[model samples]
Target: MEMVVLENEPEVLMENISNKDNRDTSAAPGLKLYRCVAVSFGLLCILQIALNISLRPPLNHTNCISNSEDMTTNLTEERDELKRKLDDLKSHQNVLKSERDELKRTLNDFAHRSNNGWLYFSHSFYYISPIKKTWHDSRNDCLQREADLVIINSKEEQEFIQRWVKNLMWIGLSKRDGIWKWVDGTRLTQSLWCAGEPNNHKDSGEECGEIRGCGHDHGWNDEKCSNSNFWICEKKMAL
Candidate 1:
């Protein structure tokens, strides 16, 4: 490189440079820059076009748009199914509510019915034909009527029944060989006996129980279940 010192006349130095360089020097540089910009822009556009063609078929517009649409459709179908399940649950709840209301109404009606007192009750009694009965035959008859031996409650209750129970009426109470029990599965604490009754076979062939011969207390006697007598049908009525 050559170095020039500008200590002499500045006008002389300027004049020399002015004559050597062209007056339209700005145009040349501007044109070169424009050409470089155009070449760079053309190369960028060509590269962009080549990249677009190199992409896969699925990256093309149709497949991409269809993929988005399919995703949306699947979401909509799942949402619809969930909504249907929710609706079914609501319907079942309504049905249960209706049934509950119906039950409440029925219960209310029964409550009113009970307030008007028309109740009936029946007690099963062990009965026997005043004639001879082989234990089996008596059991069969009781089964037919859906009833069993009569269980006399209190002493008063026994007397109450004994007055009407003529001849020898079999009581629900009995002794199995030797164990004494009432027909209602209760133990016998009290007994209505004739003076010396239940001497345990003092009477002939007396293996069961019977209510016979009225004492002032309407005592009971263990007798053979044979001998015709009008039986008392023990039942209750609430009015």
Candidate 2:
């Protein structure tokens, strides 16, 4: 319990205060550098967020346009494929129709050959009977054969008949109600009569028309219906 001097105590307190001040001043620069680094990092994060927001809408829009284009291209390709299929189907249908027509013609020709001795000429089938028959009976025979007596419409037809006939043949020409007509009810416009034919003989009444065989000029004549003669039949083709 000895009493200390006041002057020494004062000097010791001042030295301690000066040392604390020096320590505070030395730590201040490090604390300021740390605060500056933290502020720069926060600003960089905000800038990155703004950049992402600005680019997002354009990217989404580009993706939508690309999808739409792809869909349109797919639809166009599908439509073209369908059109090609339709065209192919139509072409095939036409070919089948042509084949069917050709088959029909062949069948008709075969049927004619099988039915009788038929000669094809000018889209018609002709049948010449070997035996002689009366003019009326000859017409009946043609009707039974699904035909009619030959009617010469053209000069080629008349010449062809004359060349093929070996004997007098009954034709479709006849006199009905005093007017010369064909079996089809057509009035006769031209004739290949043998100069003085169709006299309408008063004694025998030559009412039927006939064609004479080859070796004769203008091989046509009028004869009585009761007279016997070879006959010709004609039938049109199916098509």
Clash counts for all predictions: 8, 0
Q: What lDDT tens digits, residue by residue, belong to model 1 across residues 1-239?
A: 99888777799988988866765675789999999999999999999999988874554788889999999999999999999999999999999999899878756644553464322123223233455454435544555544555566677566456445566666655666566676557887877777887765644656567666755655777655453333332222122
Reference-based lDDT, each prediction: 0.62, 0.86
> In candidate 2, what are the lDDT values of residues 1-239, reduced to their tens digit?
99876878878899999999998999999999999999999999999999989877655778899999999999999999999999999999999999999988878776866576788788778898999999889999999977899988998998776667866889999999999999999999988887767777775898999887425464788899899999999987754
Q: Ten-residue segment with the worst summed lDDT in candidate 2?
A: 212-221
lDDT of 2: 0.86
Q: Candidate 2, TM-score vs. the true structure?
A: 0.60
lDDT of 2 at 52: 88
Candidate 1 ranges beyond 4 A from true positions: 1-137, 155-163, 182-187, 200-203, 226-239
